[model samples]
Target chain A: MKQFLNNLALSLVGLFIVGGLWALLSATVSPDLPSPWRTWQESKVYILSPWEKRGEMDQGIGLMTAYSLFRVAKGFFLAILIGTPLGFMLGSSNTFFKMFDPTIQLLRPISPLAWLPLGLVLFRQSEPAALFTIALCSMWPTVINTMTGVRAIPQDYLNVARVLRLSKWRQFTKVWLPATLPYMFTGYRLSLGIAWLVIVAAEMLTGTPGVGGFLWQEYNSLIYSHILLSILTIGIVGFALDRMMGFAETKLRAI
Target chain B: MSFIELKDVSKSYGPRNVLSGVNLTLDEGEFVSIVGASASGKTTLLKAAAGLIPYDKGSITMAGEAVTDFSTKASYIFQNYSLLPWLSAFENVNLAVEAAFPDWPKPMQKEQSEKYLQMVGLGAALLKKPSQLSGGMRQRVSIARAFATEPRVMFLDEPFGALDALTRATLQQELTTLCRSVGRPVTALMITNNVDEAILLSDRILALSRGPGATLSPAVSVNLPRPRGADLLMHDDQAIRVRNHLAEFLLAGSDRERPAQRPEAPAASKDVPVEASI
Candidate 1:
């Protein structure tokens, strides 16, 4: 509890420093870059009435963030569902790894931006296209981490599986799953971060009615304060998502 | 025929020979100990005999059937307590009991696991994972798992080598008692660097020479009374003689300065000679 309070206090101080710097920069150098105080004033109406929706493009920040989060959650879940087994196959079989590893290596470094057009062409719908881009980009971390996790299972544990005469199914549930959980979670955490990152860019490109869309719309209308609010919301939401994953990982490791 | 036999077993890692011309046998009820210094290929020998790994040469058999894989009838206790870290003491034993007797009802498996954990004095620690337990307690969980399976053959690979002296002695006694009280005789083969441990547990103690081409020496029978206490073994003249003989053989193999004494060991122990040693 004490440690949590300390972290909270430090984080508040960090926020203050960033706010002070932004205000100073707005006052002196970048006069059009809305000050933190101005951004708060402009963003307060949406913040206070989180669920309010005036129009399709004028929804409250909460609803916008919720849309973004839902898309990210869907894409991230798809990544895990598909990537985990792919990782297992890659880790366990030399033949499978040899066959697919070069392709995975080639695909891993490509940006979500590069895939966005491909997704649009394939889906012909903004929401699904955005989701496709998010999943395609975010999946690599989980695939790599899960593969590494499977490969990292100790020889002693494998020996135990053999010596105990555990059936193939039993070995998977009793040995493989538990051993790979922490690493799989690490992959999930990273994948979620990437999903959140990709959703913002995807929304900006596709004009989805979410936080990223709000930021892009405000940018066109020259409303810099609301753009700052969108940026802050994205950052805070991403941090919260990472914290949730970290908590889950901690619980798994405690087992 | 012996219950388990390894005839002319040899193993190598690339070009380096770890064990060569190694021969061993265990009768239906015998407890044999292969005493050796560290890196004497004792573990390699034990793993080969247990069918956990393949040997490059010769054949291993269980009741005249060539052993191709880890026998379902055997349980191995590892030196470092290879209990699953995720499982509680009870669960670890229960998993093995479940695997070994798949036809048994869940309640019966649970009962057997509980019985063995309690027998190992881990009744209070049934819920504790291997990470939560001390080294000795972890080893106890391992022992309980091995026994709960009701394996006909037990392969112990330096089972108590990692514990402190006092804990080691106590566990050794508990193991001896557990082995004795089991319903059927469990043929055991243990390998260790501790000569006193071999004398305390084994029906026959065999010395394994130092590698790169390690081979076993003639067997030194431990004829002391059953329930051999550590203190009793320390004072017994026969135990002292056996300990000295085994120690000298081990030291001779490891010593750098002394000319290699090519003792005309029994046919079972004679390897390709020590000419390859640096």
Candidate 2:
């Protein structure tokens, strides 16, 4: 608990620094810029009451934030579903590695943005398009990390597993998976963060009913406050998402 | 017929040779230690015997059957602790029994795993993962797992190399007594650089020269009395003499280094030779 608090405290320090810098810079550059205090007040007003503000769909900023988060989560989870196993196969088998490595490498270097149009074309659905883009954006790191982890298993462990005459599937689950989990989780954390990043940019292309579309809508209306507010929401939400992944990684690695 | 035989066992990787023209045999229930200065084909010889790598030349036979046939239930405990990091100590041991003896009943597996854990002083850590265990403790769990499998031929590759001296000695003593039990014997082939350990625990000691190394130097019978200990071997004169001869053979090729060339394997002789340096 003490260690947990220490880590939490450290993270709080980072937030404080970000707040301080933003406040300091905004005061000088744009006097009308959102001060940290004013932004917090505005966040409560906009985010807390997002649902109360009436519209045809009655979409409030809070509802919009929640909806965006839901989509981001769905997309992120989908990426993990697709990427993790690919990483394991590439990591475990030399033949599979040889077959997929070049293609993965080629695709990895191309921007996640480059995936948007291709995803839309392939998925044949705009929401899946955004999700697909995020998944592709994040998978490279997860796959590569997981593969490296699997490949890097110490020879000693392999010999022991072999000696024990563990069945093929048991060896993979008991020996290989556990051994490579830390790396896989590290990959998961990194990829999820990357996926969150791609979703916003991806939403722009697909115009999904989420934060990205919300940002675009506010920008079109020239509601710079809402625009700035959406940007802030993305930042805070992204930061929270990354932190959750980090926590998951630590807990998984310990296991 | 010799229970375990290596017929012209030779191994090479591409152009590089690790072991060439090597033949070795072990009697049933015998404990043989292969010792050499680091990089000797001692490990390769063991690897070939354990079926970890197929020899380029020759065949390995266990209990009159080709080693390929007896590949099942062969347990190898490596120098470095190789406990699956994900499983608790009990799970690691349990998994072994599960793979080998699926018909033995799940309760029986649990009982045997706990028994082995208790044997190795790991009874209290049944639920703890490998990362939570110390180096010595992890190796203990591995050793117990191997023993629990009732392996017909057990290969230990410097299983104590990473432990502190005190822990190494304790395990050595435990392993010695475990293997030497009269009713149900455990046949073991281990590789170690520690001469005292080889002399105390092994029935015979084979010292090899350095690598793409030379031929088997001398295979000596460790004539020491049973239930041996490290301090006892250190004081034994015959042990000292055998230790020196093996040491010279290891040092002899140190200066005359040759880029390793994997040798061709010789025909398997009936006897696993036991030369007494004394």
Candidate 3:
């Protein structure tokens, strides 16, 4: 409880200092720019109403925000599903490392947006395109983290498992998997952040019902306050997800 | 019964030979300690006996059966506090128990974990993580966890070497009592850099020579009274003699491995740790 209060106090102090400065700057610089007050009011109009559709319905931000979150969630799951096993392979097999390292390096530097067209070509749909793009963007961190985690486990731990004759499955589940989970989760957190960043661009491409799509629409309509509203929503949600992952990591590692 | 035999056992890593021509036999339930200077083959020999590393020549046999690779039921307590960093102290101990007895009732498993932690004087540390515990506390948890497995033989590779001297002595006392207790399925083989530790607790101390090539020098038998305590064990003449012999072996072995071109070595007597009575 004491820790909770301390953290709350720090957060409030930080929020007020930053928020007050932003409000002052916006109020002075341009009437077009929404002060914190105007932006908060715009957020209520654009965000809080969940039934607001993306392009077709009233131009409120709710549906698009949910869509963006869903795309990120799908991409994160897809990345975990594929990236984890690949990481295990890379960590354990010298051959896999040799084969994949060059390809991974070649591909990782190319933008997630670069894959957007290819994803559309492959999937023949907007949702799949968004997911594929997010997955592509997120995969490197997850795979690299897991592989390094697996590699970092001390030889003594393996020796103990071997001396006790841990079965291959038992070893994977008990030793290999748990040992790597922390690493994998760390990767997952990084990937989630990346996926969140990519989703807006992805939605813009797809014209999908998401904050990205709404932001694009608001720009087209020249409604800067609504655009600010969508961007704020994305930032807040992205920050929350990262915080969730960090909290989980703290709990897991402490145990 | 010559429960374990290592005949002409040799191990090499590519061009570097660690142990060569090690011939030793351990009988049923005999407690032994292997002592040596840093870089000696004490740890190497223990690893070989545990079948963690394959010997290039000869064979290591347990109960007349040649052991190849690591056996199915051994518990290894490593010196570097290799308690799975993600597990709590109780969970670390419980995991070992679960592996050994998968079918055990849940409450019973928890009870057994608590029992072992209590034995090591760490009953309050059950929920604490490895990072939250000190070096001495971590070593004790690892020891308790290994013992919780009720292993046929517990192979320790200097589990207390990293700890401070006082903590090492305290653990030694705990280990002696824990192993000597009736109806326990444990037989201990610990490797140590501390010569005093070997003399205090071992029934037999196998000194490993230092190496570019190293081997077990000779096995010095300790006839100290069982269930030894600090007060009674401090005055034992046999313990003193064994400690002196180990000190001599450790020094001579160190000198032999490196040529006389090195700085003159300290006297072996000064190297002996007389204050160690755990």
Candidate 4:
């Protein structure tokens, strides 16, 4: 209880510090800059009726956030489905790894935005293009981390498998899967973060009807307060997503 | 036919020979221990005998069948206790039982698992995972797992080496009792570095020369009475003599000083108790 109170106090102090800096900047610098007070006031309209729909392009903050989250979930899930099995194959077989490692290495460093044009060209649609970019961007971390996890399995465990003469299936299900779970989750967390990041950028570029697209529209209309509101919303949602994954990781480890 | 036999067994890792021209045989019910310096291929030899690792040369047979792969008839107890971290003590033993007797009903497997765990004094810790158990308790779980399988041949790789001295002695005593009480004869091949442990547990001790290309020294038979206890072993003159001889052999091997005289092969003289010559 004491520690919780202390943490709450520290969090409030941190918020106050940021608010104070913003207030100072708004007062001394250009009035065009959105202050924390202005951002909060602007946020109230969206917060009051977050699910309101004005138009296809002009939905409420909640709708935009939900759309963005949906895209991230789809892309991230796809990445996991493709990446995990590929990682296992690569990790288990040296020959397979040798064949594909260079290609993965080459493709991994390319930015999500760079993939946007390629995705657009391939799909000829903004929504699919955005998803493609998100998945492509998120995949590398999951694959690499999973492979590392599989490779990092302690030799003693493998020896136990051998001595017990555990069937190949049992070795995979009982030993390999559980041993690599923590590592795979680490990759999952990273991929989710990347997916979230890429979705916003891809949506912004493609002008898809999501939080990023809404932010861009607000920017075009010179609604700086709404822009600040959207930024705050994005930050909070990203934090929540990360915390959820962390909670799941803890639960899985207990099992 | 011997329960387990390794004839002119040799193993090499690429260009480096780990074990060379090794021959060993263990009859049913015999408890044999191999003692060697660190990195003397003791583990390699044990693994080869269990068919867990492939030997580059020679052959290993168990009960007249050529041992080419890991045999469910053989159970191995590792020094690290090698219990799946995700599994409880009961589950670990149950896994071994399930593997050894696939046709056994679930209830029978569970009963056998419980029996072995109880025998090893881990009945209360059946639900505890390896992470939750202490080093000693983990090893007990491992011992239970091995015995639950009712293996025709058992291989132990420094099984009690990781525990504290007190735990080691206690587990050693527990093991001796467990082995004697099994009713059916069990062939056991053990690799240990501790001389006293070898002397206390083994019917015969085979000392290995240092690697690479390590070979077995002549076997020194321990004629100490069965169901050996700590108290009995402490006061026994024969146990002390055997311990001293093993200590000398270990020390000499470590120092790279060959014994002045090499004894004839002791494997041929089945029940003959070879007195330790210092």
lDDT tens digits, residue span A1-255, model 4: 999999999999999999899889987887898888888887787878889988886777899999999999999999999999988988999999999999999999999889999999999999889888888889988899999999999998998888777779888998899999998998999999899888879988999888899888899989999888888889999999999999999999888
Candidate 1, residue A162: the lDDT equals 97
iRMSD per model? 0.6, 1.9, 2.4, 1.3
Q: Please, what are the lDDT tens digits per residue for candidate 3 over residues A1-255?
A: 999999999999999998888788888887777788777776685657666654462456656667778879999999989998999999999998999989988888778779999999998998988899999898889989999999987776786566545678877887898888889889988988998999989988788767888788777877777777887888899999999999998787654
What lDDT tens digits, residue by residue, belong to model 4 across residues B176-260? 8888888888889999877778888999998887677888987889998766777765789888777767666665564453223
Error of 1 at A52 (Å): 1.4
Best of the two (3, 4) by lDDT: 4
Q: lDDT: which is higher, 2 or 3?
A: 3
Off by over 4 Å in 1: A1-10, B255-278
lDDT of 2 by residue, A60-130 (tens): 67777776677777877887788889988998789999998999888887776788889889989988888
Model 4 segments more than 4 A misplaced: B257-278
lDDT by residue (tens digit), candidate 3, B95-184: 778777878999999999999999888998889988899999999998887788777787889878898878887988888888776375
Write out the backbone clash pairs for model 3: A46-A61, A64-A210, A64-A211
Residue A195 in model 1: shift from native, Å? 0.4
DockQ of 4: 0.70
Instruction: Summing lDDT over every window of 10 consecutive residues in candidate 4 chain B, give the lowest-scoring window.
Output: B269-278
Q: In candidate 3, residue B90 scores what lDDT?
A: 94
User: lDDT (0-100) at residue A179 of candidate 3?
Assistant: 80
DockQ top scorer: 1
Q: Give me the displacement of residue B67 in model 4, in angstroms.
A: 2.0
* DockQ sort, best first: 1, 4, 2, 3
Among incorrect, acceptable, medium and high, the docking class of model 2 is medium
Alpha carbon deviation, residue B220, candidate 3 (Å): 2.6
Candidate 1 lDDT, A169-203, residue by residue in tens: 99999999899989999999999999999999999
TM-score of 2: 0.85
